[model samples]
Target: MTEESENTGGLARRTLLRLGAAGGAAAAVAAAQTWAWPLLAQRGLVSPDGAFAAASTVFSDALYIEAFPTSPLILSPFNDPLPVLKALAPVPKTVFSKWPQPPGPGPGQQNSLRNERHQVWTSQVGLPDPIVYKINLLVRTHSFTTSQVLPIDKDGRPAVSFDAKRKTYAAGTKRFLPPSTIYGFNGGFPGARINAEYGRPVLVRFENHLNENPLNLDRQDFGSPDLSFLTHLHNSHTAPESDGNPHYSMVAGPRHRGYRPGMFVDNLYLNRPAGNDDGQKQSFFWFHDHTMDHTGANVYKGMVGLYPIYDPKNGMDMGDETRGLRLPGVRTNNPDGSFDVAYDIPLAFTDFRFDDGVTIHKDFHDGQGEFPAAKNPATHPEWWGKTFYKHFPNHGFVGDICTINGTAFPVLEVKRRKYRFRFLDASVARIYEFKLMTSTRGPKSSASLGYNGEELQGQYRIEDGQQCMQFNEIAVDGGLLPVPIKRDSFELWPAKRREVIVDFTRYQDGTPTTKGDVIYLTNVMKMPNGRKWAASTRFSPDPNYKIPLLKIVIGDTVPDNSLVPTALRARPPLPSNWQSLLDNRLIFEVQRGSAGGELEWLINGKPFDPFHALPSLKNPAGRTPLAQQKKGSFNLWELRNGGGGWVHPVHLHQEEHQVVMRNGKDVTRTPDPGHPDDISGEDTAALDPGESVILYRGFRDFTGPYVGHCHNLSHEDHAMMFAWEITP
Candidate 1:
C-alpha cells in the first residue's frame, strides 16, 4: 500500500454490501480479492496518508528473517522489577519543556529530592518475604536484529542498524544506522519479567522518566495526557491504591492547585491465592502501562512484561527434577558440564510497525479528543512516526508485523520431548487462531495479498500438510484448569493467557517423530477489520492470513522425565444453591455508541467517568459502582453483549470467574471448533457479538476498587470499562 492508495475509490455501496453477504467461506474470500481489494484500493483503506504510514510491504511482503533465533523469556534476577529502574539526569530547562517534567529537583538543584511514595502491605500468601523493585519509564532506541534491509528515508539514508565497527548518522547515505525509538520500562522494550513465588510479597516503585526523553513531544497527536504514569499488574490480587485505576493516574511535573504532581508510586502486590484453596492461586500475569485513557499508545510503545508466580507447593517449580510435577523448566546454566533448561517457555505475542522497515512509528499527541482530517489539517496528514489513522483509529491498532518475545520470525530449537509454552496475546486488537502444521513453502519475500484467506489455502491446509502437534491445555488467564483439555489449535484474544504442553517426540499419528522435522506455529484467522472473522469466513483452507509465527525445528532426543498430570487444581464449583441466587443476578451490557460521527466504545451507553458508576438496580444513585459486593460473597454476574459485529474478550481485575452459562445454556465440556476444552473458571471470557454469559465471581479477602472491561486495549482506552468495589 503506497501513499497513492490512500484515496477511497468509488466502489458502490452495493458492492461492499455484497462482500459481506451470506455465502461459503470461499465465495467471501473470492469476493474480497476480486472486488474488496480493488474497492479498498480506490478507497485507500490499506495505505495510510503520510511519511510515517506503515510500509505497504508490511502486509504484502512475507517475513524472512532466520538468524538471531531464540525467543528470550524475559526473566529478572530478582522477583522485583525495581533493581532495573534507575534514575537519569533531569531534562535541562529549555524551550522544549512544555511536556510534563519529573517533579521535585534537577540533577544539582536539591539534595533532598527523592522518590517519597511507599507501600504498606496487608495480606500474606505463605510467608511474608517482601521484595521491592524500582522501575523507570524512559524513551530510548535499540536495534532489532532483522534480515530485511531497513528502508531508507526520502533522503536515501538507510534506516537500519549501523555496522558495529563504524557508527554514523548522516543523511542520504546508504549505510546509516537508525535504531527504533521507543518508550520502555527501565529503557528496555518488553520490560523485565517478575518470577514471584507464591506467599511472598512484591512491591514496585515506578518513576516517570519520560521527561528525560530527547525526542520532541510538543508536535505529537497521541491520545490522553502526556508524560503520565500508571502501572497496573494485570489480574493481580491487590489493593485499589496499587490497581492502576485511571482515576488515580499520576502526572509528571510539579504539583498544582491541590492536585500535586506525583513522580512515583510504590505498588504492593500480595502474590497470594484468591481463597484458601490452591485452585484460587493465579500463575501467569503481566504488568503494563494503564494510564487513564492512553493505555493503547503507552503499551504499544513497549511497556509490557510477564510475571509468573511460582508456588513450590503448587507444582510451579519445574526446576526440581525429582519433586512435584517435574515439567520442563526454564533454561539454566548448570555447574556440571550438561545444561539444565526447562522446555517450559513463555511467548508474549505483540505487533509493531516501523515507518519504513526500521524506524518504528511514533504517535503524535493531541489533547484527549479525536482529530478529524477535515478540521485538523496540521495533525491529520499521515506523517512518519505515526499510526495509520493519525492519533487513534476507532477500529483498533492491528500492525502488519507480528513479533513474539521481541523477535520477528524467529526459530526455536526444541528437544524431542514434551514442553510447556505459555502464550499470551499482547496485541492491541488482533485475534489469533493458531495451528501447528507440517512444513510448507511460499515466496520468502513475495507480495502476499493480505486477508485473501482462501487463495494460498491448499498447501498449508492440514489435510494437505500433516497436522504436526496438538496442545494439552493446562491453564487459562488466571490460573490452571480443573482438567487438562487437548486441542489441535487454540484462539487467544488480547490479554488472554493459555498454557499448554506440546510434545515434539510424537507426531499427530503417534509415529516416532524426531530430529530434522520442521513445523510452524501459524495464524489462520482472517481478520482484516480488527474484529472477529465472520462466520462465513473459511479458516481451514485459509492461506491469505497464514503467517508462521515460530518455526520449531526438532533437535536431539532428550531424556523424558516430565509428565502431564491427569488433572490440575480445581476451581470452586458454582454454588449448588444457584437457583435460589437467581434473584441476585446483575447484568452489564457492552455496547457501541449510536451518536456516531466518531466511534465511542462503551460499557452501558456512557463514556468512562471514573468517579461515576453507571446506575444499576443495586446502585440507585448511579453514583455507586455497578456492583458493590461484600468481600466474601459469591455473586452471579451476567455479561450481555450488545450486537455490533465485534467479539469482546472481557477481563476482570483481581477476581477470576467461573462461567455458569453462555447464551442461556449450561456451560459444558463440549469444545468449540479449534478450542478443545471447556470455558470455565477463567479471568477472561470471549464474548461474541450479541451473546450473553453468566459467571460466578467471588469477591473475597482483599477489598477496594477493581475493574471489568474489554481487554482490547483500544476499547479499554475508550469507555468500555467500569469500576466496582469490594466492601470489607
Candidate 2:
C-alpha cells in the first residue's frame, strides 16, 4: 500500500482500539450523538476526542500500557550545568572567522561581527562586564515519571519487555522504565536557567555536540536531518547574527548548512532595553532551536531554556519583596553557579505523545522519501513509552501528555503568601487557557471516570467539580503592564509569556487558605485538533471541561511584604499622529495556500524563502520575497488573518510593538474587552479568526533579515512564515 494509505490505515486501527476501550458499540453510538459526529464520520481516522490519532499503521505486538503514575510535590529547581564564568578565558570565534574564505553564499554566510551593532551602546552605558557562559547541545535520557512499578497492560499483565528474549513481568512488578532520548542544552532537560539583570550583558558560546550518542539509542525520524542547529533567543533585541534566524545562518555562507556538529557560535545578548527605555525592558525570555523547517522537531526534542531579566535599576529587584513592585520572591544563589528565586517559578507547559509499542514511526518526511521508512514497523519494541513525534502533522501536532518543568503531572508546595508565577506555552501547537481551581472530591483516575481512547491521554488524573480562583496578572510577553489586572483565567499561546502573582494566603472569596490546602492548576481550553480551540474562555468556554495540570499544596504562612502596586512601569508614549502612518503601512496576510498537507501554510500566498532564492511573489507565477523595511525607521504594519477557521499567535522577532488598531477598531482610544492585554506592549499579535491588527513598531539599532511568523511551531515549520529585512 502507498505510505499515505498506510497512514490512513494506522489512524483507523487506533480509532478502533479507542472505540473498544470506550465501551465498544455503546461508546461509538454516544460519539455519533455528539455535534462532532459529522466531522468525525467525514474524517474516519481522526479522533473526535482531543487526543492524537496514530500516524502509522503498524501496531506493536507488545501489550498496550499507560504512563506509570507519579507522586506529587516532585517539583524542584534544576541544576545549572556549569558555573557562570567571570571572564571569557578563550575568545569565542564566529563561523566566518573559523573559515575565512569558505564556500558560496547560502546557508553559511555570516552577516554581523562577534559583538556586532550593539557593542557601542553596551559600552556607552558603562554596564558591568558581560558574563560568559558555555552551553553544549547533546543527547541524553530523561524520565517523565519517577515511578518504579511497571505500568499495567490492557490484558491485566505488566507490559512485556522489549528484550529479544521476550521476558514478561508479573503483576505489580517493580522496576524503572527506560528513559527517553532527548537533544538537550548542556545535556539536560529544561536546559539551564540564566538569572540575568538589565545592566549585565550575557555572552553565550553554544557548541553543537549532537553528533555524540553514547547510548546508541534509535535517534527517531524527526529533527534536523543534518543534526545542525540555529538558536534563536525568542523576542530578544540583538544583532541578526545572534538572533539565530535562518536568514543570518544561510547568508554570505562558507558552510551553507546550520552551525553543524563540533562548531560553536557566540551569541551576545545586550540586556539593555530597546531605545534605552526602561519601559521597554522585558521580563522573561527563552532560547530554542530555530533551524529552518525543523524547529518543531528540534524543540520537541528538548532544546528549550529560560532567561528571566531583572530590572535592578528601578527597585524591581530580582526577589526582594521590600522594593520596586514588591512582587513575591526571595533570591538564592546556588554554589553551583545557578540561581533560584523562592516564591518565583517559571512553568513551561509542553505536551507529548508516547510510543504505544505498537504504532509504526511514520511521518510526512518518510512518505516524501526525505527519510527511509522503518524496515519493520514493530521492530523497535524498545521505543514503547518513549516520546513519539511526527515531523509533518497536517492539522498540526498536540501532545496527549502535559508536562511542567520537564516532569509530567508534577506538584509544587507553596508557602501561604504571594508567589510570582511565569507561565510559558512551549508546546508545538496547543494553546492553553489556565485557571486556578479548588476541588472538593479530589483527584480521580480517568478510567474510573469512563474516559477512554485518546481522551485518556493527558487527563489521566483529574479533579472533580473544579471552581475558579482569581489572581492578579502583572505582566505579559513584553513586560509589566501599565497596571495589574485581576483575572480569574488567562489564555497562553505558543511562545507567549504571562506573569501573574497569586496570593496563597487567602482565596479569591476572602476565605483564608491554611496549611495543607490543595489547589490545582487547571487547563480549560479544549482543542480537539491544532487547527483551533474547540472551546476557550474567551469565546465558547466549556465550563464542565477542566484538566488539572499542576497540583499546589499550601504551607505555613511566610513574612509578607510584597505589594501589588496600582501603577507599574509606564509604557513609552506613541506619537499622537501614529494613525497618520497607517496609510503607508505594510500589510501581510497569513493564510492557507493552494498546496496540500505540509505545504499549505503560507504568508501572502507564498511559502517562506529563507535563502531569498525564490522568485518574487509580486509576479503572477512567483512566490518568493514578502517584506522589507528601512533600518532606524518607525512605521505601521498590519498583520491580517486570511480566515481559514484557524487562530494564529503571530510572533515578530527583534522588537516589541504597540497595538493601535485591531479589526479596524481604534483600541488605543477604546479598550477591547475581548483582549484587555492589548493595552500592554507585545511582540506577539494574537489574531483570532477574521481579525487584523495594526501595530506601531520600530526597526531600529541594527539592520539584517529577521522573521515574523505564526508561533504555532507546526504552522511555522510547514511554511506559514515570512522573512523581512531591516535595510541599512
Candidate 3:
C-alpha cells in the first residue's frame, strides 16, 4: 500500500454510521458480514463494526456474566516440563509464523502452547465458556550475536573506558537493532517463570533468534521493528550488560564486513542483595524486553515473565511445606497430580483491546507515520482499529478486557485457607484499585459494609457490594516488608507488584466465614482516560474501575499448610557514611512537554539517550551517564515531579531503594508483625504532581549500566527514563 493510502486508511466515523444502520436493520447480518475476525487477524486491522463491538464488550463481558474456574491456578517455580538445553541460530523460522488456532475459538488465536518448540514446557487449560477462552504458554531458545559490548580501558579499569573506534559504532547504521520479530522469553508469552536463589551466582545466556523480518516491520513508514533486546531484570544486582539498560540495547544478525553482529548477551546475576546486606534482598523480580523506543509495545506483545529470587536458607521458601519458611509454595502437587506454585501464586494482571472480530489490537505509529501523534485520523478511509478520538493515538491504551494469568474474567476455586497472592500489574497503560467482595443474587444493594464488620471501599452496583475481605500486605516491589500492613484495598500502578496474604477461612475480625460463600476480585479505580487517579483515602476507593476481575467460589476445605508469619525479614541499617552521601544526592526531575502537537514524557528535560554522558567527578569523561556512583557505594536520590496533574511511578533498576522522606517530611513508618522486617524500601513509587520523594539506594556487588524510569510503561516508552553507571 502507498504511504498516502495508508495515511488515509482507518475506520472512519461515516463507516461507523453505516455499520450502525446495518446493525439496526439486521443484527445477525451485520455480525456475520462485518466480523471478518480471521482476515483481520492476518492483516492487523479492525473494521468499524469490530471496533464498536470491541469498545462495548468491556462492560458487557464483565458486568453481567458470572463465571467459574474450570482450570487450576497456574503455579510458577514450576520448571519447563520440557527444557531445551541446546540453542539454535536464526531462531526457528516458524517462530514468526501465525500461531496455531486453538479449537473452537477465533482463527489464528494463540492462548496456549500448541507448537513443538513451545509444547515442551507449556500446555493449555481448556474452559467451556465461549465468550473468550484459552490459556497459552510461550517458550523458546535462540542464538545470535552482537558487538554492543560494554567497553573497558586497557588497564581493566571500568567506567574510565577506552576504544575510540568502539564509540563510532554509535554513529554507524549497524549501531541500531537488526530486523527481527519480537517474542516472549524461551520464545513464548508470559515467558517461563525463572526461580533463582538470592546471593547465588548464575549465568544466563540470551540468544536473539527473532525472525529476520516480522510483519509489523513490513511497513517502514510506521512503528519500531528493532530486532534487538535489552533485558532488564527489574531490580537485581547484576553487571551492566545484564541490567538491560535501554541505552545498551543489543541487536542480532551479521554485521557489515569486519564487524561481528552483536546477537547474544550474557548477563551475570550476582543474585546478591542490593547492597550485600541480607535485609535488602529482593524476592520478587521479573524480566522483560527493555529495547529503547519499544519497551511498551514489545512488552505489550508479551515479552515478559517472572523471576522470583529466594534465600533458600533464610527466605520465605514455598518449595516445600516441611522446609524454609513453609509458606504455601510451588511443587505442592494438586489433586490432579499436576504441580503448581501453590498458595504462593503469581497473578500477572494485564489488559487488552481486541478488534470486533475478537483478534488482538495493534496500532502502527512510527514517529514519521501519518497522524504519528494522533491515535485516529478524523477522516480516514481504512480501518485503523478502534479509537475514541480522531487522528491521534491515545495518551495511554486501556483494553476492555482484564486478564489474569492469561484468562479473561475466569473463576478461581480457592480452598478455605490462607493464600499468598503476588499481584503484578503488567498492563501497558491501565491502573487497577482492587477490592475483595461477595456476590448477591438479587438486585444490587447499597450496603457499604460486609455482613460482619468488614469496611467496604466503594459502591458495587454489580451485586451486594460488601468489602468483606482485607489484605495483609507483606511486601512491595523490593521484597517482603519489615512488617505487614493490613488494608482494605491497595492501588496497583502498572509494573508494580504487591505481596498480600488473604485468609479465605475468616473475615477481618477473625470470625469463621461461611464455607460455601462466593466472593469477587474487583477493581474500583475508574480511570476513564488512563490518567492519574483521584486523591482519596485508601479505604475510600475510586468507583471508576469497579469491574469484577476474578470470581472466588469457596471450595471444600483442604489441609492448610501455610501461615502468614508474624515477621518476614527486617531491613539493615544504612551505612555509617550514608549521611555524607545524602549531601550530594542525585536529583531527577520527572518532566513533560508538548511540541508539534505531541506530548513528551521526559526526565530532567531530556529523552533517554544511552550515550549522553553525565558530567561527574568519578568519571570526568562523563561517558553518556545520567547518574554515576562508585561501586559498593550508597547514595541518596530525589524524584521530583514536574506538576501536570499526573502521577509517575518511578522505578529504579539494579537495586531497591528505601523511601526515607516524601515532600520534605520524614515518612511515618508503619510496623507490622506479619513481616520479618519493617516496611521502608521499594523499587517503584507513585509520585503525584507537585510531590517529591527521597530514596536511599545502594550500588553494591556489581559495576555496570542500569536504568531508572517511570514504571507507567507508556511514560517510559516516550522517554521518561535515564541511564546511569556504577564505577569501580
Candidate 4:
C-alpha cells in the first residue's frame, strides 16, 4: 500500500475503535499486521504509531474521550489579569514557638537570625526585612473546566450530587460530577502567584496539611504514599536547606524522605542573584513538590506554584513601563492587599487525562507486588471523568487534555496592545512548539476531522489556512536574553520557561488587528506517546495538525508604552582560559538502562544514589568524585545524551550556565542555528537525541548537597538524576 493509503487506513481504524468498535478493529488490525508489517518495513515507513498500535488501540477503545463535549463554547473564559494571592501575615513569636507537634524549638532557636547555619550569611549580606508568608499543602478538589459532565460512583452508577442550597443529594435532581482530588498549595491548583521582587528576601513557613481531607474523596494511588511533602523552588540559587531537594532532605533536614503531616519548615529565599552579580538576576521560577521517587506524581497531583521575581534596580523596574525596558505591564494594588500587573500574564501549560469511566487506572507499582493486591488496589472506577494518572509510564506520561493556568482550552481577551507572556511547560513529558495563528475558520470537532484518541486532546481544531504571528522572545528559563529573537514559533520542554512579548495591535505582515479578531495560541508539535516528538514545525512540519490551546480575542485598543528592547540583560563573560578546564571537566551521560518500570531511566548507568557520588567519564575507575564542587569556583561540565531515540531536558539546580559548546561546535562565538537561544544563560539544557552540550557553570554563594536531573519529571522520579555538592 502507498504511504497515503496506509495513513488513511490507520486513521480509519483509529476512528472505528474510538466509536466503540474496538473488538472488530483490533481483530482486523491483528489479521492485517502479519502481511502489512513486512510491506511497511520494506518501504521504511514504519511509524511510531504503528509500532505501538496495540496500546493505541486499547487507549482509543476505552480510555479516550474528547477534551470537551462542546467546541470553543465549553472552553473556560480566561480570568482577566489572572489572580494574585495575598500574603499571610507573619505568625507572632509566641505562636511560632510551638510549631512541631511536641514543640521542639523556640522562636529564637529557629529564627534565621539566630540559627547558626544562616546567621553568618544573614548578617554578612545585611539582609533586609524579610517578607514572611505562610503556605500550606493540603488535599483539595479542583475543577479543570466549568462545564459539567457525567460522573460515576464506586458501583458504576451515575454519581449522586449534593446541592449546597438544598444540603442533600436526595433532594437534588441535577447530576453534577465531583471535582478531581488534588494535593494543592494553599488549596489551589497552579496555586496562587507569588509576585516577588529582588532585594527583598522571602521567608515562607510551609505547613503540610495533606493529612486533612474534608472533602472525603478517595485519594488516588499516585503521589507519595506516605503523604509527606518537599517543596523545591526550581533553579533557584539558594542554600541547601531551602533548596527543597531530596539530597538535602534525606541527609540533613528531616533525615528521612520528606516533611510529615502537621509539620512545618521555614524556607528562606535570599532573592539574591548568583555571585551577587547584577547580570545574573533571574525573573521566572516555580515552586513544586520534589519528594524522592514521587516528584512527578506529586506535581501532577497539583502541588505547584508560580513565582515571578522582578528587578527594581537600575531602572529595570517591575511594571513601570515609563522608566525601564517597559515590558508590557501596569501595576495595580488590589483592595485585598494583593498586587497585580495587568498585561504581564503567566501561562502554565499542563496536560492531563480524565477517566473514561471504563479503563482502570493502573501503573507499574500496581503489578509490582509491593502493595497488598486486594486491600490497596491501584485501580479506581469511581473517579470517572476525573484526572487519571499512571505512575510509571514506560515511555513517560503525556496527557490527552491540554490546560493553561489550570483551565483546559481557555480563552483570553487581549487589548490591542503589547503584552508580556511568561510561558511554562509544566507537563510531564510533552514538548510544545507553539505559534500564534489566526484562523479564518473557527474551531471544529476533531471527530468530524477523522482524528481519534490522543488526537482528540484539544477536541477542537482549525483546519483552514492559518497565518502565523511573530513574537519577540526576550527571556528563557534563566532570565532575559541579551537580545530579543523574532520567531514565529518556539519549542518549550517540560519545566522550561520562555517569556515573549506579543503585540496584539498588528500582525507580522503589518496588518492592523481590529476588535473581534480572534487569535489562537496553537500547538503544532505532535508527540504521540512522549518518547519523542512525532513531528515538530522546526524540523518536520505536520500541516494537518494544530491544536488551539488558548483563544485570544482582540479587544478595544489601549494606550501603548511597553517596549521590546533591542538589548536586554547581559550575561557574565567567561574567563579567557575557560577552555583550559575542558580536560578535567566532569562528564555525565543520561540514557536508558535495563528496560522495565522505573529502572529504565538512568544517568551514568546507575540509579539515583544521593549518598554516593558518580565518577566522571575520565575517572571511570571511580578514583575521582565528579559530583563534588568547591564553592567560589567555576568549571566546565559536559552533558551527553546516550542515544535511545529519546530527548532529555537536563536541569541543573542552584546556578544557570552558559552553553559554550554543542556537539563539539563552538556556540559561544557563534549561536547555534537550530537553537539561537542557547547563547542565553539557562538552567535547563534541551538535549536532542545523541546531542552533547558543554556548559560553563559556577558554584558559588552557599554550600551543601544539591541535585541535577532531567526536567522530564518521570525520568527524574525514576532514576535519571544525580546528587552534587558544593563544599565550603
All candidates: TM-score: 0.73, 0.81, 0.65, 0.83
| Candidate 1 lDDT by residue in tens digits, 142-233 | 44433423333323223332332234334323332235556677777677666666766666657777767576532233422345657788
Tens digits of per-residue lDDT for model 4, 1-728: 12232132123221321222335445435533665566556656366434334423333333222122111123223333333344334444455456542112234332222332442244458767556667889899888777543332322233333322323343113343457889998889897578778887776777889999987776856777768899899878888877889888777766555787876777778888998898889899989899877899899999888988889896595766777888888887655444678888888889887754345444435443223321333333355456777766667888766888788767788899999999989899999998888788777756556666456655667777476589899999889999899988899999999999999989888999999988888888888766789888766888878888888899999898889998999899889999887877888899865332223467877767777666677633344456889999998899999986888999999999999999999899788887888889999999998999999999999888898999888888777888898888
**Arrange candidates by lDDT, highest first: which order?**
4, 2, 1, 3
lDDT of model number 1? 0.56
Better of 3 and 4 by lDDT: 4
Best model per TM-score: 4
Regions of model 4 farther than 4 Å from truth: 1-121, 148-177, 333-338, 367-379, 596-598, 619-624
Return the lDDT, model 1, position 256: 12
TM-score ranking, best first = 4, 2, 1, 3
Model 4, global lDDT: 0.73
**Where does candidate 3 stray beyond 4 Å?**
1-182, 212-223, 250-262, 314-318, 330-340, 356-394, 442-463, 534-545, 575-581, 594-597, 614-626, 668-678
Model 3 residue 167 lDDT score: 29
Higher-TM-score candidate among 3 and 4? 4
Count residue pairs with overlapping backbones in model 3. 55
Candidate achieving the largest lDDT: 4
Report lDDT per candidate. 0.56, 0.69, 0.52, 0.73
Candidate 4 local Cα displacement, residue 155, angstroms: 26
- lDDT (10s digit) by residue, model 3, range 56-162: 33212221121111111111211112121111112122332332332222221211122111111111212122111111212232211122212111121112211
